[model samples]
Target: MTAISESGPSGFPPGYFLITSTATGRVLDVGGQAIDDGAELILWPSKEVSLVQSRRSPEADNQVFFVDDSGALCSRSSGHAIDIDHDRLVLRHRKPASFAHPFPKFSYHQELGEINVKFDGDPTRNMYILTSVPLRKPKSFIDDASQFLTTNIRTPFASLFGGVDTNSTPEQMTSAGVDLAEDEVLEEERGEEGEIDDSPDEKREIHMLTIPHQRPWNLAEKAKLRRRFEIIPLRTASKRTTGITV
Candidate 1:
């Protein structure tokens, strides 16, 4: 298969063009004309392109895409680059050149009519972008857990123990002016009032009851936990089509 780089043998420069799948005869479309990030790319019916006019047609912005110099395929309407999100294609804000993201570069096969997307230029992990069906929302166990911890657990836990340094040891708390002797004072008061129950049953009950000790939750550690996702190509059929240009 003859591979075509971003600058194709057809001498087509990086400009807005309708990317149509030869297999499905459907063009790459931003689902629902969504302008938000993480919008899925789907295959939709191709719109008519005016060959004579060099300008874009109205209401066709969602269907037209262009390859940037970085080889990122970006939608004309949203200006977001197409990237792999949980193995599905999604739109994301273009990261600054200095920042490195897992976005791959796009190339084409001249004879096969296939778009070749490679991550880190690895041929073993080459992915094809082709699908007529709408993509389902991606789910991640780690993301859900992170969200639950951040929203339901962490917030309330922090508020309940406001100003209490959970990270501090008992000695650190004492050094920080915490009245550790208050418990001893209460015990002394109970002893003076003869309120100490030295009954065998009471002692046995106390011995049986055990509180499991858990490590103090560190809010700083949450910052280090990153949300991980993978890009998986949708392989719906074997008869892949060469993506057409409009």
Candidate 2:
């Protein structure tokens, strides 16, 4: 199996990708192309049975995923994020609840080639590693059982992104908006540039102008009225005051 990269390929943000398991050689799929909440994730054969195939496979939208800014693996078909519930992986709404944070953040581990889940900003917790196991569902939920995607294993079952698959070409990667050459050029340009200075260029004094309330304004009424104020920079105010009587 090809070693997975620690980080995603260049320009990989917001790009569609297939998460294929190294153990079973199957891709992570949403069961029944489901868009509803609590849909279980399963491992299914790839549309073309090749890791190098195009991401535009017919009826493969449920298989395509992109990492969101929050680091959640989001499904393109359901617009939901992969979440852990009762030690099982399922698709859930990405919105955060008042009591808990947003969906758990996921990071790719190069050494183990597994996707690690982080919860409540704790990394040392012996959480779970994404793995594929024989489907075990309640008889009431499903009649037939197959392979299911899970995260309740100690040993990590490595998965590879289609963009970083060894067999994938630059053109194939570019189809998902990853341009290796362009990223290389940009990286080189960044290295040649000088260090950036984040300090403010100039200091400015601020003067707030407040308008007094009318005579009829009582203390309560004054409190109710919104305060009107304007800010004047020291330099600009000084320029305006030049040649004017104080």
Candidate 3:
């Protein structure tokens, strides 16, 4: 349960990252390094180079874009951002006047660690999903941001993801065809070792300190996090943009 760092004022970590599509397995790319205003953004098949770029340590912004506070994806080289034009995502000069028309606000899906980009003043219409290539996908949706941030993204799902068990050994699952539910597999193993009825007189070592040490909770720190999530707006907006509709 490693804690995730709070992304900056822009609601995203400032660095170079490859935005990918979960449905298409494609990466969001700028065409021809276009710097003209209104240059269109398109999806391209992810390449080995794209993977390398996605995992690159935050360096020079060659293929990288900076997410600004207004939800604009700013090109590092051009100093422009991907602005919304009608329904199309394009590169444009981000200015105060065009803010209402082009810039998109974003929402985070806690379950999958996916970012949903939607138009400002509108929430439902034309929502686009954004993901990173190197990041680990989350297991299940958690309501609390603090809890979600602390959760392990690689945790195995009991019902979803084709029945993967993080605790199960490869040999054990290989014998079961890896199709059975994790509990069922564990039950069979438990059956082999019969349940024992322990006597009160029997002495067993109790590691009391281990439990508390495993989950270190500080009241002041938890209250601080709770307050932060409250201001952060975890819930999605109810309405979408004016022109777009479901």
Q: In lDDT terms, which candidate is top?
A: 1
Q: In candidate 2, what are the lDDT values of residues 64-91, reduced to their tens digit? A: 6777766677887877888877646688
Candidate 3 structure quality by residue, lDDT tens digits, 102-141: 5665444433455556655653333343322111133245
Clashes of 2: 0
Model 3 regions more than 4 Å off: 1-11, 46-62, 96-102, 123-246
List the candidates' TM-scores in order.
0.44, 0.46, 0.39
Put down candidate 1 lDDT per residue, 125-151, tens digits, no spaces.
323332222121333799557645545
Flag regions of model 1 displaced more than 4 Å.
1-13, 52-56, 96-102, 121-246
Please rank every candidate by lDDT, starting with the best: 1, 2, 3
Better candidate by lDDT, 2 or 3: 2
Per-model lDDT: 0.47, 0.46, 0.42
